[model samples]
Structures are given as structure tokens and as C-alpha cells.
Target: MPSIARVPSVPAPGDAAELRARARGALLGLAVGDALGAPAENLKPSEIRARWGRITGYVTDRPSGTDDTEYAIFSGLLLARHGSALTPAHAEAAWHAWIADRAEGQFRGAGFSERGTLENLRRGLAAPISAQHRHAWSDGLAMRAAPFGVFAAGRPAEAARLVAIDGSVSHDGEGIYGGQAVAAGVAAAMAGAPPITVVASALAVVPDDSWTARSLRRAVAVAHRGERAVRSAVVIGGYPWTDLAPEAVALAFGAYAAADGDFKEAVLTAVNMGRDADTTAAVAGALAGATQGESAIPEEWAAPIGPARGSCLPSMAGHHVLDVADLLTPEVEEGVALVPGTDLEPATDLVRETDPLRHNAWPPPDPTVFVLAPDQDEVRP
Candidate 1:
């Protein structure tokens, strides 16, 4: 019933202030969308209310993550501690740290399907992954991948490398590509590029020959084609009701296409598209948030997207959310190495010749939160 032309507006100018605002806005968008859809996971938006009832408002109190959001937040925490470093040794330390935390029940509340991560941690079977089918390879890797893209804005490839590492622990192939594609979108958005161009950069890393790539490729095509695009995706992209990945991508395509470059429309369109609505909405919202910032998220939705339980950023208190740019300071102490979360062994030889300097990586000042035994919270929150 909505006009297909209702696209969200991009932020004003490309000033650092604007860019930072947009980045924080995107993070908020990611959290909002993530939390909104939390109650609906595998259900269709329609079935969601029946199954879990209306989510009403911030059901959790602060933002808590399923695997997608958790992995991304974890990646951010890793980067925050190390500044901008990505060395193999650092990578190993990170994973070892994550494993130790698991032993201590740091991630005890980790979601259902994500229990696989715990399995991997228990057995130490995860391999060093750079590309394709590295591990679990599920959509979770792609779900919260936008932040990395924002962190590596202006450096799409750098963004991809970070994605490769973060994803190596749990995703592979099209799964990784999904994360890469989304990350590229965020990076380009932060860099102030148009949707058309941002998507193109994302495609460069997403295998143009695969299912994920095919969906995105077709989505771009539909953005210009309209109803026919929808038809193409349903026929080729598959329905989300069948599974979250395909159906989610289909809705993402329609939302992105219809929004043109508008973040709100992009998200709403995805939400309205039905199955996996929450995640589809989140993906579209993140891309849009990256493009437009907090301003792009309609004021109507902002009020309710606050202080949920399990939120990593407890400062949000009980009912608050950060806008874009607020996430950026050019000043968060960028270098600190606490416990590492992912394995660096396999990527060792491959990364040594190409590891980015290890600059940001640290544990939360809340040592009580994670399971890192030997790791004490050196800094206070």
C-alpha cells in the first residue's frame, strides 16, 4: 500500500562529522533492527505476533545479539582493543581468548543455533579461513557485518579482510560473501557513494557466480526494473519462508531497489516484504543507516530502540540509543591487546606477508562479562 517511490534521504555533505554521525546511526540501526527481529527469528513477520506476540518495545533492555550481532560486536570489541591491527598472531590470541571465555561461561547466553561456535571452541576444529566455506558459513556472519565495513570505510578491501577474519570462525562461501557484500555496502555508504556504486563495490568480493551474488546482482537489476525484479528474485532468489538466507536476500533486493538510496524506505520495504522480515529489514536498514545515518531512521522508530537487556553498551541505560557519528570519536583509545577470540593458525602463513598492523584489540573493562580466566579487566568502564 506504500508508494514504491518513498526513499529515505542521505545525510548532508561528507564532512567528518556527518560521516561519523552516519556511522553511529548505522550501528544503532543495526541494533534496532537486530532487536526488533529478535522475537521473530525463524517466523514470518505475520506469524511473529502469534508466536511471540508484539515485541512492543526494547524486549531485552539493552542490545543482546544472536550470533550475527554478537560476532560483529565481538569484532568491534577486538578492533577497539587493538586499534587497527590484524596480524595472524593477534588473530590466534583473540580466538584463544574467546575459547577461554566460553569455558568460563562468558557467552553462556549465546543463542540456540549459534551453539555451533561453542562446539568449535570445545574441539578446536576450526581452521584458518581466508575465503569460501571456511566454517559454519551461515547468514549470521552477514547479519551484523556492517560495522566492520563502516570501520574500514574508504578501504573496501580492508573491510573485506576484516570480514574474512571475523567470518573465518563461523561462515564460508556465500555466507562470507553475504558479509562481504554487506560490508562493502557500509564502507561505500560511509565513504559517501551512491547505492548503485556501493553495491557494485560489494559485488567485487561476493562471487558474481554464486547464490548470494546472484541475489544481490538481481536486486540491483530490479532496483532499475521494478515489479519484474520481484518476479526474478522469487523465481531465482527463492523465498525467505523456505529459509532465512534466500528469502531474506529476496526482500533485501526489493527493499534496496525500491528505496533507490533512501534508508527508511529500504528498511520498511524489507520489513513489509514478509518472511524473515526482521533480518531482511535489519540488513536493508544497516545498508541504509550506513548511507544516511541516524537521520535516515525515521524519528518514529528511534524512541523505542533503546536500552535493551544484554546490550554491550550498558551506558545506554534503560531507554536510549546512539545516533550515527556518536559511534565515532577518532579518539577511542585504539590500541590494547587483551584476550584474542579467533584462531590465527591457518591464516598465519597467508597473513604474515599481508597482516595489517595490530592496533586495536581489548577485553571489556567488565571482566565479569566474558569468560577469560587469566584476563583481568585492566581498565574500568
Candidate 2:
């Protein structure tokens, strides 16, 4: 068997202050971008231009994240509790308890893939089976994948592995690949990897020929020509859904590469591109935030971000991203003995024990799942 290439370990943070800043930057950056881009979701570039004239900053007076920020909180809390021991069953149960079994009004702000997962879970389906619905390829998983990267820090492969576990319940195939790419990229960024190496880390996780990988490569290839060219290269014409995993992932990485990991530029570039605006910008924000640290984000942009409004997942209300950031990167103290397994449970036996490569294998494991035809005029809330 050919040996897998070894990825260099990202050095642990030199001190607690740097760790706190990076973690806070990543989650807070995601929320800021999500709020900034909500108004532009599903709109065309021309329409965005006509309405906001390049969208240099927040467009609404009371800018708050939509489904994107809320879902990240949902996933972040789970990762904080489970750490690397997270399993599909744990994720499925979290879905049921926090979302699926909740009141219908609480589930209002989810995206297509989440809606599909909730419906399947409500109907008593289990994961892998539960993920077998239409719209499984949406960017839902990718949008919330940053916490895995933050937790894994310098371990890109571990980040990819954990995110695949989290994604298995709600997405498959390209959708999973998209989340892996983002997780790997953010993991690399958290470790202080350069912009080019960060992008390389992203490409290393998913198969080269997969739609997510191909779109990402194309977008990065033309990133030097600026955001418009990158958008033109990756976006699917005549496709109604703005949340396709491949397209959204590509656009986000493109924005990251274009800005060379500059928080403001990467986020604004994604926001202006218009398709799946919230997700793309949120992803860009995560990547750039991890690379630059929270202090690097503009004060004005970070100010309005309070605890999530929980428009989507009501249980997540009042749970601030900053609080989650602190949880993921706790302050290191002197003379405090670390206790093992005090907070987290031991790894569950229910975890799938397959080769990690099998998760991203070509032709996908199950091809019988139906692909819904794109409806150009359909708008999802």
C-alpha cells in the first residue's frame, strides 16, 4: 500500500493570548460575514450593484446572521462538548434533540440540506440513510465546518476526519467534500500557514476530479484576475439554488486566495459576488480570521456581533461566538493539573471504522439517491 503523505504539525500557540485571539477571530469572523452577506444571498452581481453599489460594509442597520451563524453555533457547541470523539450517532442525536424534535417554529431558518436532514430525522431515519434526501449537496455543512478546523488547529488531516464525521449525518458526496475542504483550509490557517499553503491544504483533502475540488481549483486559478473572473469561472449558470456546495465552496476559497487572507478584503469580495453570499462570505471570514487573529478584524465589523439571534435554532440563542471561542481555546494556567475525560465522554463504539479515504471515494458509495432538478426561480428562506 502506498503511504499517505505526512502533513507537518502546526506548532501549538506560543501562549494563551494568541490562541484566544485566533479562535475568537475565526468564529466571530464567520458571524460577521454571515450578517454582512445575508442581504445579498441569491441576488445577481448586477442586482447587488444596483441595490447596494459594491457593498463595502453592512447594508442593514440591525445586521444579524441568518441560518449560517446559528448553524455554526449549533455545530460549534457539539464540537466543544465532543472534541475529536464526535461520531455520527452523536451528531444525529444532536440533530434530533436540538433541532428535529423541536417545535416547528424553532426550525424556521434552516437551509435546504438542513431541512432535508430534519425531515428525514423526524420520519425516524438514521444517518447515511437519513442523508439520502434531495438537496444533500447544499453548502450547509461547509458553512458550519470552521469549528472543526479551530479545534484541530494545526492538524489538517484530523480536521478533515472530524468534519467528515459531522457532515455524514446531513451531507454526502460533494457536500461532504466541500466541508472537508473548508475544514482543512481553516485548520491550516489556524496553524499560521501561508495563504498559498492554506489553499493547498484545502485541495489536498478532497479528490481532484470531484466537482467541489475542480470548482475550487478553477476559482483559485483565476483569483488573480479578481472576484468577477473567479465568480464567472465557478458559478453554475441557470441554476436556481444559490447554496450548491461546489459553487459556494469555490467562491469562498477564491475570495480567500484573492485577498491573501486579509479579513476585510476576503469577506467583502465574497459578499459582492452575490450567489450564496452568506455562506461564501462566512467561509472566507473563517479562513481569514484564523490566519490574521481576532484583533486584525476591523473594530466596527466586530462590534455588532452579539450572541446569535437564533433565528434558525432557538436553543442556540444567547450563545455568543466569543464564548464558544473561549471554550475551544481555554486559558493555560500554571499549577493546574489537567484531568482526562472529566468533561468529554470516551469515544463511542458507534463510530464507523472505515478507511478515511473511503469517506471521499469517487463515484460515491451510494448512487441511488435522487438528484432534484434545479428550479431557477425557487427561493429558499
Candidate lDDT values, in order: 0.52, 0.80
Residue-level lDDT for 65 in candidate 2: 80
Best by lDDT: 2
Give the Cα error of residue 32 in candidate 2, in Å.
Answer: 0.5
lDDT of each residue in 68-120, candidate 2, tens digit only? 88888788777765676678988888888777777644547488798888888
Cα RMSD to native, each candidate?
12.1, 10.2
Cα TM-score per model: 0.67, 0.86
Candidate 1 lDDT score at position 371: 15
Poorest lDDT segment (10 consecutive residues) of candidate 2:
368-377
Q: Best candidate, TM-score-wise?
A: 2
lDDT of 1 by residue, 157-193 (tens): 6566676677666566656677777776777777677
Model 1's alpha-carbon lDDT is 0.52
